[model samples]
Target: MSEMQSTRRGRPGYDQQGILAVAVAAFNEHGYDATSIGMLAERLGLSKSAIYHHFGSKDQILDLALDAALSGLEAVVDDPLPASAVEASAVARLEHVLRGAVHVLIAQLPAVTLLLRVRGNTEVERRALTRRRAFDRRITALVSEAQAEGALRADMDASVVARLTFGMINSIVEWYRPGGREGADRLADDVVAIALDGLRRR
Candidate 1:
């Protein structure tokens, strides 16, 4: 059968992406450990078999959902500065990463929220936590570099700065509604302003 026909045969109109989206929302609502295939199937209005048609197990779904959040963050960290920003200061590069992180968190709010809630109970959660630590290290390194360059304060620990900075950013998931008075750009601007204002050396 053709791809379209195969999709219909497998799960009617629901594809992996749609299924994953619903699954992630449920994961966020009920906790990953509490969410089961049966619950997901009920949420999707499909049978367990139909849910399995897209994903092999609920763990696989959790893996994918965590990846959705981690990949966006990894991309923000890995992406090189624009050509025009090649000569930018360490603080400037740090600011860019912060803005990118806010954008990612806003765009992938559900996945990010789920990621933040993981406690390494499963292999997938452990792996995500490892990647998250690596991301945090990169931020700390950047903060250190900025401090070394006399851009940010020298007295404060870089790791502390990184944690506190991300503490602010990660907290966005709690109250950041998409279509609220504050748009992503405005939020990014405000985050950068608030964060960098405190970090920037006098």
Candidate 2:
């Protein structure tokens, strides 16, 4: 079967955002293997060919959807640290970046969740994993700085700390809702506080 025929949809037309919204929802609900282009087209009232026009194949669609989520994360990581060394300590800079990351994770939870779930079964997923590792490395560097500056506890390995930190941050995707008792800002504060100060109250 042709790529479109196998996927059961045409290139995506209409608003790219709208199409991505529908496609991501479909992928989330049905999973990558189960979702068909026909179903997506039916949902959007378009032909399978329409989606194919927008995306070359199912994998292409998945890559674009995943990118949409990771792009938000990339934005957070790309933010510049304070220009003056005295302006903020390493820990403060780390907190700022973490807070920005929380916004990205919460705002783009669906896409990010999908992005995190990739199993490396395809080339797209493998590429996603590489990018995810790079992001983690940058965070590790910040953690190392925090340790050197005495802002963060130095007992633990920076790589280990970075892994745990991101592990906690990424977990937000699993449980976060758009509106709840705590919003993104509040959640970010709570996360940073919990990280900086242990759960035990003095």
Provide TM-scores for the models.
Answer: 0.92, 0.87
Q: Where does the lowest 10-residue lDDT sum fall in candidate 2?
A: 3-12
lDDT of 1 by residue, 45-154 (tens): 88999878778889999999899899999999888899988888989889999999999999999999999998999898999999999999999999999999999989
Cα lDDT, all candidates? 0.89, 0.82
Candidate 1: Cα lDDT at 162: 99
Reference-based TM-score, model 1:
0.92
For candidate 1, give the lDDT of residue 182: 95
What's the C-alpha lDDT at position 40 in model 1? 86
- Name the runs in model 1 displaced over 4 angstroms: 1-11, 199-202
Roughly what TM-score does model 2 have, to 2 decimal places?
Answer: 0.87
* The candidate that achieves the highest lDDT relative to the unseen native structure: 1
- Summing lDDT over every window of 10 consecutive residues in candidate 1, give the lowest-scoring window: 2-11
Alpha-carbon RMSD to native, per candidate: 3.5, 6.0
